[model samples]
Target chain A: MRPAKTMKIELKVNGKRERREVPPSRTLLELVREDLGLTGTKAYCHSGICGACTVLLDGAAVSSCSLLAAQADGAEVTTIEGLAADGALHPIQQAFIDHFGFQCGYCTPGMVLLTKALLDEVPEPTREDIVRYMGGNICRCTGYAGILASVEAAAKALSTKD
Target chain B: MRPFEYVRPTTVGEATDFLREHGDDALVVAGGTAAVVMMTLGVLRPDYVVDVGFIPELGPELDGSRSGGAGLRLGALTTVRSIERDPAIAGAYGLLADAASQVANVRVRNRATVGGSVCYGEPQTDLPPALIAMGASATIAASTGVRTVPLAGFFEGPYETVLQAGELLTEITVPLPEPGTFGCHAKFTVGSPENKPVANASVLVRTDEAGRCVEARIVMGAVGPVPVVAEAAAALLAGEVPDAKLIAEVAARAADATDPQDDLRGPVWYKRRIAAVLVERALSCALRKAGNGTR
Candidate 1:
């Protein structure tokens, strides 16, 4: 058998440049929650089926648990912990708070980040667009009504702020 | 996941060279959606995992101009989301776009690639049937040379492909639809559209000036070990202007072509029934598109 190998990867995480030597099996989710101490990115289903591990990679949402940290060698990753700027919660986070987009908070981080990705791409997304784009991030709590309202509120808040 | 050696190759030639030396114990991964999941699940524990995501030539690109004869050339790394949204593909191969749009959710589509999806050879996928119906072919690269194989013959069985250990799929070429050609892809999932289909069907039909069906190809997926090309069903539609009755007959024939194994999604009988229903719906849709030229 070949010897174990580790890869040296340098990537921008939450606007801060960080470098790490990650094993081949070290997933982006592990790098975020374990190594970087950013627990905001949750790991639910280690598989890609659940969106609990969603994060923004180069402004697009992906399941962090579904990819290797080495694969994200030179990319920008935004976890839920990175949403606040200068102690002010991002508008998407505020909307979730106002609309109660989550319950139990297990799926909240992913939901909020995914909403950010959506609003960034489509500033004023229609209801159908919201439903379609956010379909992957599943929330077991609130049966999605609150989540839907939260996404709409976020889109409106961002558009108005723009 | 087990500890393993990680290798990232920047070129296809380099990738194939490494694979030729370590192919027995190495696994090539692009997109990492399927591979990482399998590794996490302990279904695959390779001593070496080759990351092909960085290879510049195996791009995340969709070039319609280079596809000779009005077809489309899709890089192995082209994300499914791109295929779903690209205006050129949407205009010329709407059925392909429709199939791509229904793959998982935006997140998975954003990460999964057309080549990876096809190469994975998982029977219950959305892209293969549409590609097969469209007469697409795959371009594979190896240390020896390169070869193009029809997508219809790319798979061996469930989660099995004809890709050799030292080989990699570079691109897929979707041929131009003959004039007067229209196609439709229909999938029936047990739950949300994001779920893998219990059964799916893709139908492409061409109509002559006299409105007679000159050619047809129907491919059914998820109901067999590999996607089934329903030649008998296509034969029935030949030389006839497809009607509701004739389409129903073709649907039955297509369903008869399936060799579905019972699983959680559906039983053998249920899959066959869904296959027939999807074929009927898809054929009806394609014929409607042909009549109106709305495709």
Candidate 2:
């Protein structure tokens, strides 16, 4: 059997454009963590069942672990590393801190990213919206009460932003 | 996952050609939600992945477009979230929207395409039975030409469909329900909110002016190799007013039609029981929506 050829592809990651030659089997999670050195995006379950590897692709939240890097070619991807700007934590991040949204912090990155996507789509989400949008991203610690509160607080903070 | 070659076909013709050339060695990936997961789990190993996700025809946002007198046409690439959030779908085809909403979570729904879900042919999925109950048909295109397969008969078995080697599912057209029709989909999930259904049922009911049952479609999913249509159950509701006793009978018939197998979700008998319960609940919900309460 012959070795598979690597393909060169470009991606817009966290406002930065990156070009890399990767094997087809390299997943978006691997691309972010390994190639891009953005380790904030955690990979708990390599399969799609867990939302620990969630990222925003073109503004839609998707499981990065289940998305091949080749499929994300020429696409804009936003990981947890992308949320902070100019040494300032994003409002969602601040809200998570204030509410103590996470205990172990393993699922924090994915949760925060998913919250960013949800807030972008629905700036003023209701409790139900928060639950539904954040349903995929599981947090074993805190039992989700703090996470839900953080999302609600973030939505309020975002709505008040000038 | 084993390394493979990726090919993004710009056109359906090109995609079909690749599929034909590679045959079993190639797999077509749309959203990559299911395909990527399966591949990473070593369940599927295709040497070549034909990605049609970038095809313009498949990427355009779905719009409300009725075909002649044939109801709404949903392009194959329509995302599950798109269907779940579409107001037109929510208002008219609530069963479909409900089913779409219940699939996995928002993230998966954002990436999983409707065509991918249907083509995956997983018996436990929510769309098959809901679409089958809605009298939906799929338009399949290939190197030869195009043909439509009724969604009810589209499935051959678990993870199997009537789609040929080189055929691509282009669109799924759901006919306008009869003027008096109302439907609902009920799914019973045992574990988390994102867990696959142990048993699901979709019921479409059409009542006459006098509130008598005129037509009905009862479909049970996740209990068999394919979405099982309770033909006998549906027949029992035709031409008569539905009562609690009749609904129970129909539900029993639907349960009897199931060929459930013991799996991680539940035992066969448990799923059979859930199927009966879901059928009754779905039928009652549909009736309530139709403004006809069971007597």
Clashes of each: 0, 0
C-alpha TM-score for every candidate? 0.96, 0.95
Runs of candidate 2 with Cα error greater than 4 angstroms are A1-4, B66-69, B292-295
Query: Proportion of native contacts in model 2?
Result: 0.64
Give the per-residue lDDT of model 1 (tens digit) for B1-295: 9888988888999888988898889888899999998999999999889888998898777665655575888889999999888888886688898788888877788899998899899998999999999999999999999999999999899988989999989999898888888888899998666677899998889998888999999999998899999999899988998888999999999999999998889899999999999999999999998888788
Residue-by-residue lDDT tens digits, candidate 2, A10-91:
9999999999999888999999999889999898877676799999999999999888898899999999988899999999
For candidate 1 chain A, the 10 contiguous residues with the lowest summed lDDT are A1-10
DockQ of 2: 0.53
* Reference-based lDDT, residue B86, model 2: 82
Q: What overall lDDT goes with each candidate model?
A: 0.89, 0.87
| Candidate 1 displacement at residue A34 in angstroms | 0.2
Worst 10 residues of 2 chain A by lDDT: A1-10
Docking class of 1: medium
- lDDT of each residue in A68-131, candidate 1, tens digit only: 9999989999999899999999999999989988889999999998899988888999999998
> B1-295 in candidate 2: lDDT tens per residue?
9878888888888887777777578788888889999999899998888778888776447765533356878888889998888877776688898788888888889889889999999998998898999899999988888899999889999999998888899888898776778888889998787778899998889898777899999998899999999999899988877889999999999999999999898898999999999999999988888884321
lDDT of 1 at A30: 96
